[model samples]
Target: MGIRLPFMVLHAKQILKSTSQNVHNRNKYNVPKGHVAVYVGELQKKRFVVPISYLNHPSFLDLLNHTQEEFGFNHSMGALTILCKEDAFITLTSQLSAS
Candidate 1:
């Protein structure tokens, strides 16, 4: 348990450093801590600020995989653009929140 502390601290420091680098962007969007802005939709993309914790869930990971396969990470929106309908994304997130 004690041995893991230093690695966790270092990892946290790295995250803080990267977050500091994006401070300007975060401020521009007013994104709250522990949340991330993602664009979801096919024809007309819509932005949604979702809990960062959702990334760890299998259902969310599946959506991410679909985005990766479709867009290859070079999103023109400059943010994560999920490849799914707006209603579908809403349903998935709602389900995640329920569970």
Candidate 2:
């Protein structure tokens, strides 16, 4: 059996908060420039519009560095990569698990 880490939930919450704040701040400044906006669904659910340009933004870099220090190098790298390539990673993981 695989051992699950207890701090996973806490780490997840921290990451979510960090990412959400990054998105929020980006929207505040970038929206006026027509660089970013929120994705609102018919049901009123909202998702952040994260552009590739935001990857090098100061706030994003700060969050990335903070997350790396908190989560350690490898885990943080994997998490970031997954976020960058979500659909492909999900498909690969699902295929591997089905075998």
Task: Identify the leading candidate in terms of lDDT.
Answer: 1
Best by TM-score: 1
Candidate 2 per-residue C-alpha lDDT over 58-97 given as tens digits, one digit per residue, 9 for 90 to 100? 4444444444455443442212322223343344335534
Cα TM-score per model: 0.74, 0.28
Query: Backbone collision count in every prediction?
Result: 0, 0
- Please provide, for model 1 over 1-99, each residue's C-alpha lDDT reduced to its tens digit, 9 standing for 90 to 100: 344334433433454355447878767777678776778888888889888788767777777766665665555666667778899999999999999
lDDT of each: 0.70, 0.38
